[model samples]
Target: MNTTKLNPPTQKNRLITMILAMFLGIFGIDRFYLGKWKSGIAKGLTLGGLGIWWFIDGALLLMDAFLHSLGKDSGFVKDARGQDLRLGLSMYRLKDGRLQRDWFSS
Candidate 1:
C-alpha cells in the first residue's frame, strides 16, 4: 500500500480574485481564475445568472475576506482545488490573557 501524501496546489490570491469578480464577474472570469472551468462556462453563458449570481459571488468573497482578516476560516470562498485564498491583512495581536486577544492594534 502506498503511504505517501501529496501536497495540494498553491492557493490563489484573494485580492486578484475579488478584483476579477467585482469587475468581470458577469463573464465568470473569477471562476476561471479559480480553475473552476465548468462553473465558469456556465456563469458566463447565463450572464452570471442574470446578474444575481455575480452579486452573490462578490458578496461572498467580500465576507470571506473579512472573516479571514479576523483570523477566522473562510466559510464562503475557496478555489477549485479546495484551498483558501491568500486574503486579508493579518496583523499583529496583543494577548490580553490566555484566552483573550486584541485585533489590529498592538
Candidate 2:
C-alpha cells in the first residue's frame, strides 16, 4: 500500500487561480495548484475526467473566486518580499519557464 497521507489541498492565489482554471484548468492545472496531485494528472490527460466532470471541475475554480471575494484569504501565499503574493498555480510552463514540485505535498 502507499504510505502517503492524504491531506486537504492548499489553496493559492485568486487571480492566478482563476486564470489557471480559465485556461489550463480543464486539464487539472487548478487541482495541481491546490495540491491534489493524483487528480491533477488524471484530469489533465482525461480532459476533466472525460468531460463529464466539466461542471464540477469548473466549480472548484469558481469556489475559489467566491471564497476570495469573501475575504477567505487562505489561498494567498507570502513571497520573498514578505507580502501576500498572487502567484499562479502551475506545475509546468508551456514555454520559457521552469517546472517545480512540492516535495512535501505527499
Candidate 3:
C-alpha cells in the first residue's frame, strides 16, 4: 500500500501568482512561479491551450482567493509540492485502508 505524506501549506504568494497569470500566463509563468515545471512547459508549448487554459487558470485563482477570503477551505490550486496555496482540503488513506478526508491544511 502506498501512503501519501502530507505537508503543510506553502507560503507562495497568491497575489504574485495572480499577477503573473494575468500578464504572462500564455508563457506559463504562473505555473513556473508555483514550481510546477512540467505543467509549465506543457502550458507554454500549448500557448496556454490557445488561451483557454490561461483564462481558466485565472478564473480558478480568483475563485480560490474568493473562497479563502470567506474563511473557508478552498484549495483549488496547489504548488508542485502537493501542498495547498492556502488552507484547504487534503485526502489520505488511513492505515486501515479507508479513505480519509483532511478538511484543511495549516
Candidate 4:
C-alpha cells in the first residue's frame, strides 16, 4: 500500500489579525482584514452579540495567532503589508519593497 502525506497551509501576520479581532471584531473588521467578507458582514450585522461573540472570536483569533507565531500551520490568512494598489487583491510588491496580498492563484 502506498500513502501520501499532505502538508497544511501556513498563516502570516497573525498578530495583526488578533489585534483586529480583539478591538474591531464587532464591525467584522477582523474578518474583512482576513479576507472573509461574508463572515465579516455577518458579524457586523450581529453587532458581535453585545460583545460576547466578539470576545470569543477574539480569543480564537489570538489562539490562531499564537499557533501561527509558533511556526505551526493553522490555515489562517496571511496579512501582507504594502502592495501595489493596481494589483487589485492579488499579491504584489509595493513601492516600499514589501509584499502585500496573497494574490489570486491562477
Candidate 5:
C-alpha cells in the first residue's frame, strides 16, 4: 500500500463559498467548489428552474456555510482544485511537503 500523509485540507472557507453562491451561482461557479457539477449545470440551464432552484440552492449553501462557521465540518466534499478560495479567507494549505497554517492570513 502506498501510504502517505496528505496535508490536512484547507479550512473550507464558509464565507467564500457563500459569497460565490450569492453572486455567480447562476453560472454554477459556487457549485464548482463543492464538486457538484450536475446540479450546478441543472440550475444554470433551467435559469435556476425559474428561480425556485436558485433560491433553494443558495439556501442550502448558506446553511452549510453557517454550520461550518460553528467550528464544525459541513460534511461537504472537498473543492475540486483543492486550492485557496479568494472569498474563503483564513485558509490553510500544504507547502514544502508540510502543513501551512493560516496561509492567507498576514
Candidate 6:
C-alpha cells in the first residue's frame, strides 16, 4: 500500500468551497467538491429541501472553516501546508512529493 499522506486544500479554495456550499448547497455543488458525489446528487435531486437538515449542514461547514482559520484544529484533513483540504479538487504537488493547496506557493 502506498501510504502517502494526503494534503489539504488552500485557504482560498476552502473559502470558495464554503461560499459555494452556502449559496448553492441546494444544488450540491459544495458536496460535489467535497467528494460526496452521491450526497451532492441527492441534494440536487431533492432541491436541498430536506427540511432544516440541509440548512444545518451548511452552517456546520462554515463553522468548520472558521474554527480552522482561528488556529484551532478542526479535526479535518489538512494538506501538507496544514491548510484544510476540501474534497474532489487536488492540490499542487511539492518537490518533496507532498501536496500543497495553499494560496501562496513556494
User: Per-residue lDDT for 1-106 in model 4, tens only?
Assistant: 3332354234334555667777888988987876678778889999987787798877765655444333344333444332111122224423234444333423
Query: TM per model?
Result: 0.75, 0.47, 0.69, 0.53, 0.54, 0.57
lDDT for predicted candidate 4 compared with the true structure: 0.57
Per-candidate clashes, comma-separated: 0, 1, 0, 2, 0, 4
Off by over 4 Å in 1: 1-8, 89-106
- Poorly placed runs, candidate 2 (over 4 Å): 1-11, 71-106
* Reference-based lDDT, residue 46, model 1: 100
> Each model's C-alpha lDDT?
0.78, 0.53, 0.73, 0.57, 0.58, 0.58
- Candidate with the larger lDDT of 2 and 6: 6
Summed over model 2, clashes come to 1
Error of 3 at 101 (Å): 27
How many Å off is the CA of 9 in candidate 2? 12
Q: Looking at candidate 2, what is the lDDT of residue 75?
A: 37
Give the lowest summed-lDDT range of ten residues in model 5. Answer: 84-93
Residue-level lDDT of model 3, residues 4-105, one tens digit each, is 446534567666788899999999999999999999999999999999999999998877766555554436888887666643222331323444433332
| lDDT (Cα, 0-100) at 97 in candidate 5 | 53
Best by lDDT: 1
Better of 4 and 5 by lDDT: 5
Instruction: Give the Cα-based TM-score of candidate 6 against the true structure.
Output: 0.57
User: Which of candidates 1 and 2 reaches a greater TM-score?
Assistant: 1
Query: Cα miss at 64, model 2 (Å)?
Result: 3.7
In terms of lDDT, the poorest run of 10 residues in model 2 is 87-96
User: What tens digits encode model 2's per-residue C-alpha lDDT throughout 27-79?
Assistant: 87766665667877888888977675555656655664444344443433332
| lDDT (C-alpha) at residue 80 in model 4 | 38
lDDT (Cα) of model 5: 0.58
